[model samples]
Target: MRTRGALSASGASVLLLALLVLVPIVVLLAAWQQEQWATWQHLLDTVLWRLVGNTLFLMVGVTAGVLLLGVSLAWCVATLEFPGRRWLQWALLLPMAMPAYVLAFVMVDLLDYAGPIQTFLRQWLPVLPDFSARHPLWVVITLSLVLYPYVYMLARLAFEAQGRAVLEQARILGDTASSAFFRVALPMARPGIAAGLALALMETLADFGAVSIFNFDTFTTAIYKSWYGLFNLQAAAQLASLLLLFVVVALWLERRGRSRARYSEIGGRQTLRSRPRLAWGVTLFAFAVLFLAFLLPVSRLLYWVIDNGLMQVDARFLNLIWRTFLLGTMAAVLVLTLAGWLAWVKRHQPSPSVSVAVRLATLGYALPGSVLAVGIMISFSAVESWLADLGVGIVLVSTLAALLLAYVVRFMAVGFGPVENALQQVRPSLVEAARTLGASSAEVGRRVYVPMMLPGLLTALLLVGIDVMKEMPATLLLRPFGWDTLAVRIYELTAEGEWQRAAAPALTLVLLGLIPVMVLTRRRSARLS
Candidate 1:
């Protein structure tokens, strides 16, 4: 009877989660099917192919740039001890604290002809031509700087964690260092490298802020324009469906790459890998990458804030910060609650249906925020329609509730992944023992599992909070009237080329972003220690 009760509870919880997760996808499909054929034809005739081409171009460019920079820097720092190498180990990650949009604005202003860099350059060399930041090259460069840290972090960890014994064995078999690295170390690290690239590619695909700021059109921007510009939700829904196809393909590639790469952990008590002596060539190269990636953009932000002074942080600014913080907190709390429930269900009762639901729920991480927002609006509009049909005037459309719901759908994966991992780590023996002591499933969770999952729960909260705080496209697409966040403020101000005014909010976002970076750093430190 007790087992049956547990199963019943698990089934109920899993079913609810599955429905909630399915809402957006189902709504998108329904919206697409119900739309006039003219809408799809209009998209096909005009912007669909262009959006696909631009998205693919940016994805390929950014992926290539990130891989080159991330892997090289990872190899350099992991193997060659250089000046400031220890500090570079952590400082390389600072750029991760800045959103791609923030980086976009910084790069645009600093590299502009009227800006200091060009102003000074023209003074010495009158032959230099003025360059526009809107160029596709600049967009790729700006995004690569902020996004490369994702790759760098993962590749560094992978490179450091590799089996040093294998490399040495290859070398002893008359292989050169370079040859051993190419044949042995690189293949073993492919899984981590692939995972990092997958993350970067997803971020690139979902990027509306950077692309919009730079006037680069992609599927994300197209989806937004379809909904707002053309005022056609059906067109938006169809575009989002197309975006999902891109995500599915990327995920399949990532999975295939990972499956083809494997490493065995056969040996125990592995010795620490020694770093080679610092060479000036390597030292300068590391510093150059660090200075370009971290010091330049951050230094520019700090400078503008100081130069702009107190006017930037007036009553309006404080309100923006407060609203942003409150929204992020509420969303994070709600997501954590939903994540905890789903994680518990997956842990307590593993079934095929539950597994599929879990996959569907977490898959949004690969989706662009604009796609998610469009799908969310479709679902929300349906609920509003149903409510009106039932003779009630209350509607979620254009309400704070709608925006928060969108955040939950889009960012639940950000919170859930960590919590699910924590849940997976909890010993089944411990849960079984607790049940043997006459504890109900609920009590067992509260008394035994909750405490154990606290670390991941906290981590999830921080991650979701930071992501919500940084999120732009979804918030822009779904926010209620008069609802403005720091992210939105930054987007608007930066769009108008108001870099000085945007600096304060940008700085705050970066600071709020540091919470996750600090968490990552502390965790890495703990592991190393």
Candidate 2:
């Protein structure tokens, strides 16, 4: 009777959650009901095609850049031995600690005409050509530098999991090392590499901060312009729906690319291959990437903080940190709870309906935050109006509840991935034993599952918390009045071109982001070892 009751309750929750997720998508689609033909015509005449062209261009450039950087770095770290190879394996991930926007503004600060780089260059070479910091290529490079780890981390695992045996077999068949890598190892790692590529592309599509800094127009930027610049929510929704189409197409292509391939890992401790000249060259290349991506940007941020005293942590700074921490904690707990419940239900029920609902529920992670923000606000406005009509007088739009809901929708997959992996490690036999011993469902969960899932739960919390802290687009659009976070603060300061003043919040975000990067590095290290 309890088992049936639990199943019914879980199914209800899953269905409700799935519906809640679908609300935003539905609202975004229904936004066309209120026709804004003038706005559509203006967008089409002026900037619509430009947005599409720039977005596709950015995607193509980032795709090539990340593939080159991620795959080569992953290959070098996973299969080759070189000077500083062990340290570089994890050090390469440090770029993930810097938000692409932070790097974007920093690059502009240092390299733009008014900044130090050009100032110094002009002193020696008076006729230096003026270079635009707002170039679209810079946007692609900035995003690729920060986003490449998504590809590298996964690709490294794929290569490492293949072990030395497969490569050795290929070499013994008279294949050169380069030929063996291209033909044998690369093809086998295609699924993982593709998965990583998809993630990187999704992030690129969803990015608002980086592109905004570069002044490069894309769908994300267009959505923002429509909502804030033009004050048209429906227009924003229209643009968001278009961006959603891009995301769907990217996901479909990624899925189709890997659908027919099957990969089996030959698991063994990979013996690192050492080639002296190639090893040193790889070391040089890796160092250059790490320096440009992580070290240089970080040094500049630190310099801005110290050289410019406006960033001194005062009462306002503390309040910003406190609010950011509070929001991150709240969102982390809420997302983890939902994710854990969903994972548990899937474990117990394992039905097709539940699986489909869970997938739909987590699909929000692929969506741009601007898309989610517009959809959610539109949905909330309807709810607020309905409540007002019923005399409840409760408000939802621009409230903390709305913001948290956006966070949950945007980050459910982030929390779910860790919790699901942890839950999968819990033995079914152990669960059955608990059931046979007369433990109630609640008791079994508390006594058996809680202890086992603690590590993953903590991991989920940390990940979700950090992601919430760094998130810009949703927070910018959905935050309540006077509830500005570090991310929002950075965006505001950067928008005003106040790079020096923004250093405090940007530095704080980077430091906080490092916690998760360190966690990932440690986990990856353990696996490789």
Candidate 3:
């Protein structure tokens, strides 16, 4: 047990953190009784069902597409041996660096009537009609290509981590290779696949840019339209609350489905490399997936860079690079500082209320960025009003401080999870030993915990930095004039159908995003080996 004083300090910390996190959510919810219900009923009678239907359809389609693409590719990469398999294992994850909205832009542009493909077709076969890119299903295909790598990375790591004897036992029972895979390997990897699906689904639900580009009115787009178009913040808040309910339900279903079985046969001698090979067709299938998933978007950007050449790299471009870097760095430092401190507080003093508060604080990552932006706008507007009554001038929106605060709220969980896990893995005996030697809490953290936690701390920083660089919706709304980062620039250019201009920033974002994924997988591969 900790000292009474320490316990009191921790309880206070929990209340403070939870209050900060919950105020925005509570404010959004309070819009219900304060606003008129005439518009709410009108929304239900008019476009709400259409929005719900479109959103649900996209979710189902994207989930199926990612599972098919991600799981099949993961199985092939883990089980089959062939040419280029070594490189493909990591290279397949490259699509994760390509944001779904960017991929949507590339796909729509290339398939349009005047693009290269249709132009070549007209030159050759002139009788055929123009390519049509209007169907909403294209959104599903585009999102899946970029997002499948979430499932691919997690499922591959999970498949590689399990012992091989489980499969061999299935073989001894006269099970076919396919049977063994379906009945044995798949179930064993359910936990990891479920986790990956949850992440992909969360992104799918939170998606605003891609759906907007494609003219598909999902709930996120509706939220923005309600606030920005109708100027009805109340309607937007209600839409956001409904969207959040959808996310919570989806997460619960995934968890319950995955809770059916427990995995205990974890470590054994036989491994993914040592497993028997299937046909070489699996390699061809994987190659085709890589072409569609990664190569298409990248090749389009490469052509842009090649054509524009040095003309694209000017003072304005350099400023974007600098501002993006500065924003990412600041956001990373803030998330790490708050997340590390909160996690350390929990480690030193564990109580049920504090644990629940920490969990609530982490839920921001699940809410859509547009929803968060609306909540933030409402909360800040109230503060500004109060300050005005106090005879003081204050501007929070369109300020760097507000933008960074939203980033921390949206992404702190990315930093906190690794910190908590790293701290948990340290032997409690080590801490107790340090305490017995009359070390203060800070001294014990420095002498005992810091060395072991440096890697995780660095990982949290890099991940949060990459996420901040790629973050779009909140930055789109909150950034002050002249504060356009790379992602904001990409969204702006892509929105205007200027793919050539967007290509430069989009590619830069991709390169930066790839660094963290590469580092993370390398660490995982080392651990599994």
Q: Give per-residue lDDT, candidate 1, residue 490.
A: 89
Reference-based TM-score of each model:
0.92, 0.96, 0.93
lDDT of 1 by residue, 1-529 (tens): 3397787777777677667667777777777557468877887798778888888889789988899888888877765656677777887888788899988888788888788888888899969875775889988887888888888888887777764677778999999988988888788778888888888888888888888888898888888787888898888887788888878777887898799776654252245455455456766876777677667877888898899784555788888889999999999999999888888777767788888887777766776778768877877777789999999888787788888877887887899989888888789899899999999989987998888888888899999999999999989998888789999998899879898888889888988999888897887778677
Using lDDT as the measure, which candidate wins? Answer: 2
Worst 10 residues of 3 by lDDT: 268-277
Model 2: residue 26 alpha-carbon error in angstroms: 1.2
Which prediction has the highest TM-score against the true structure?
2
Give lDDT for model 2.
0.90
Candidate 2's error at 369, in angstroms?
0.5
User: Where is model 3 more than 4 Å wrong at Cα?
Assistant: 41-46, 123-130, 266-279, 431-444
lDDT by residue for model 3 (1-529), tens? 6689878887787667667668778877887777668887888898889999998898899889999999998887876667778888888988888888888888888878888877888889949864577478889998888889889988887777666777778999999989999998998888888888888888999887788878889899888788778998878888888888878877886787588858655574344543335546777778888888779888888899889883658999899999999999999998898888789778777788888888877877887787788788888888999999999999976688888878888997899988888878788999899999999989988888899888888889999999989888888877888999898888778778888988988888888988888888787768757
Sorted on TM-score, best first, the list reads: 2, 3, 1
Backbone atom clashes (below 3 Å) for every candidate? 0, 0, 0
Q: Mind sharing the TM-score for model 2?
A: 0.96
RMSD of 1: 2.6
By summed lDDT, the worst window of 10 consecutive residues in model 2 runs over 520-529
